[model samples]
Target: MNNPFPYSEDNKRYYTWSHYLKTKYKNKVFKVALNANFTCPNRDGTCGVGGCTFCSSYGSGDTIEDKFEPLDVQYESNLKIMQHKWPKGNAIAYFQAYTNTYGSVKQVSEMLKPFLFKDEIVAISLATRADCLSDEMIEYLDFVSRKKDIWIELGLQTTNDKIAKSLNRGHDYQCFLETVERLSKTNLKICVHLMNSLPGESKEDMIQNAYKVGQLPIHAIKIHMLYILKDTVLGKSYLQHPFPMLDKDDYIDVVVSQLEVLPKHIIIQRLTGDGMRGEQIGSEWMFKKTIVLNDIDKAMVARNTWQGKVLETK
Candidate 1:
């Protein structure tokens, strides 16, 4: 069958990160997840406490193999492991742990300066919150982006402010919009993270989130199903009184619908998340990452739909 999507090298119906990197850089590219030893405002008593209800004790950095090591050591160790697969590939230094931009301008600069000059490092990705970004921090990041590709990853798990408050997210949807507006004037690329199946949200609510953000000035997005892990508030609560969650087939359906609404030019960084084994308490279906992604592909093909299908009609 012919692939209707114009941006894909393979038969994928949506724009993929691999296609974006291969077309731009002409080589394999991967992210080396690093723990920058930063803490969030909510976790450190600046706003609230205990972090997000779903965040684990590692602040969602459980996948970082050498998280406890120094930043340089952590980057070198992980990059070497990834290069064993793609021997000549370049890397994006991903600050995957807590709020990477929660510190002062000097602290953030010190953390990123070493990696900026490395030849093998092609870009830097920092996962941060909207309320944490100060004017000075934004200026510094914008300045550094002139030297190297800078990606500021903001987590807006859901658009519903009520749901956000229930999870103790610290900030609301308005904060995210303001932050994106500020970053839009800079050279930095913005990637927003959205999670489906958050507590108290419906399938329509999830699709609406895609519709709204797809109209923004975002360069990319990462969507994943929420997985409850042990040692977290949500996990402990689920153990006592479980809430309804989406099954595999329903999750694929929602993901395909999300893609249909999203613009084709925006890169789909990730469609599914890798839940750390032995720690995840519910949503066990996310363990089969490849199967979930393949099923989403099949669903899109079966419906004869490509990305931006709805937008084209409008």
Candidate 2:
């Protein structure tokens, strides 16, 4: 593959997270996802109720194993999978379920304490909402960022407040901005999650959100298309009245356009995300994830473009 991006080994036209990890660790590093047994404010009525309309029962940590087991057991279980996938690789324990830092700073600390001592764990990734973070949480995360690699994945979805309201996102755009500003002070690697083809959002809306997050001090991003899952609010709505979804071709175009508008230095963590085959309902294109990603790569090459290719240089 022609890796013209200069930051990857494949034909990917953007800076890939895998490339960055390998370069930083000098070898392959995997994130062994763990279920920390946390709940979201959206689900618990702190922010609203019933959680985001699209979230699954696993709190988006569906890949995590042994939810009922201790952290040590979960770590070893995921480690075995990673070892088989990449036998020579190092790893980091990823606290991926719900609002990992929603609890008190002390509680969050205890959940992370075991992973801190693991020689094989090179970094820690926290997946949570920006508004869920408190001052105490930020202070503790900042402290850990100084000691080891601490990457925070904030679920921004889209910066459009209207869409946020429609999805029952609980927080507004300003809240996400404020949260980013706070985390910026710590200088930790931040990755934002973005969604495409959301209800009531046009293609332009997604591109503008891409432009906005690109201007932030974020180090990476994960781009996902909205997928309606069964037993959720979105699923109920879809059953009542089906909403338009991006097809495979349209999705690839949107993803490529997002990449073109983003800053080249921002690592592309994932091009798209998926729910379980059985649970996922809308956006049937999600089933062909590999093909969709390949299409994006091929489209970028055909257009002779790459990340930041459309951005105006100062």
RMSD of 1: 0.8
Per-residue lDDT value at 36 in model 1: 91
The lDDT leader among the candidates is 1
The numbered model that scores best in TM-score is 1
- How high is the lDDT of residue 295 in model 2? 86
Local distance difference test, candidate 2: 0.86
List runs of model 2 lying over 4 Å from the truth: 1-4
lDDT by residue (204-288, candidate 1, tens digit) is 9999999899999999999999999888998999999899899999999999999989999899999998568998886778988
Distance from true position, residue 176, model 2, in Å?
A: 0.9
User: Residues 7-37, candidate 2, lDDT per residue (tens digit)?
Assistant: 7575578998888887899989988988888
